[model samples]
Target: MPKPSAVTEAPSVVGSRLRQLRQRQGLSARELAHRLGISPSAVSQIERGVLQPSVARLIAMTDALGVPLAEVFGGPEQRDEMPEDLTGFALQRFGQGTEMTLESGVIFRRVSPGRTPGVDYFVSTYPPGSAAHPESGMFRHEGYEVGTVLSGELTIDFDGERVVLRAGDAISYPCSRPHRIHNTGSVDAVAQWLIVHPER
Candidate 1:
């Protein structure tokens, strides 16, 4: 008797390949999620090696990406995972007082010390009437900037276009766009950012 087709379990590899397919198709996470009938956060988590999809979801992903199921779960080519360091953190705190006040209710801050400086890393929480810190600076930086609005309201200025974002939304903006953030809400807003640079 012939054996049934099987899919190996590889959360990391599958997730990475899924992202690769999305990029090749020129589809953003939001776009992919819209196709998959899931939230962008779900797609982001799946791509970041955080969440593994079920059999049904795997079929959906393959169909949406127009790829074979084997390809989705088959690429483990990245290499063995390396150990991560959790030291050298100078300080860590919570609450609005310790964060940078960009505006009346906007707070900007680096998620951790010794992170990529020009990366402009942060998890800002903006209250009503609060605006993002870059209201005036509208600075430019090297590398890429990607962020996910975990909650509340957020806005990003890309050149001259304003993209208003809500909870579970994500955005990828070129650091060369002279962009800035704005928190226009009557409630608290929060988002996480990731920036790439030469070294830690």
Candidate 2:
């Protein structure tokens, strides 16, 4: 299996940022935990950087906090580089975009120059033998996702069906269905992914 590049940003960065967003949203840790169906200590652990959340858990937190997944990867901070009155376009230089690597070894690299209220744009890399959801379980959320594989093999297990994607293959599905993204190939699987959140 190909080794992924070492990502140096500590998990604490994301944990602290998540805490900030939760507080800004006026949600108590316990309340957020309740919403996520997890325990308060789990939330606290994540905020304190003692624990790194899985991809599904992180997405659930973002959904609970009403922020796009990119925000967890420093989207708001990246926007600081843009003009206050910026209107039409945004640019993210190569290797300059923020990224968040989940505890699952799946890396989500933000490609969008700024936050899109109900959308997430990024390049997701699934290391060999890595899966997005924890413990081989399925994850469901409120959105629609489309991914185009760039290299290696990416497998989508959804609604009791399994589909394998290779370079140049694309797949789209409603997030409401239980699904999992896994890299079952020997090499790293890289793909461009976009998720459109359900209208509020």
**Which pairs of residues have clashing backbones in candidate 2?**
none
Candidate 1: give its CA RMSD in angstroms.
20.0
lDDT of every model, 2 decimals: 0.59, 0.85
lDDT of 2 by residue, 111-159 (tens): 7776466789888889999888877789988789999999999999988
How does residue 66 of candidate 1 score in lDDT?
61
**TM-score (all chains, Cα) for each model:** 0.43, 0.90
Q: What would the per-residue lDDT of candidate 1 be over residues 1-200, giving only the tens digit for each residue?
A: 55222223345655777899899889999999998788999999888768755423554575677653334422343111112353434333343112333225344444543322334455666776555432355655445768899888887776768899999999886656676666666678888777554332
Model 2 whole-model lDDT (C-alpha atoms): 0.85
Q: RMSD for each model, in Å, please? A: 20.0, 3.0
lDDT for model 1, please: 0.59
Give the Cα-based TM-score of candidate 1 against the true structure.
0.43
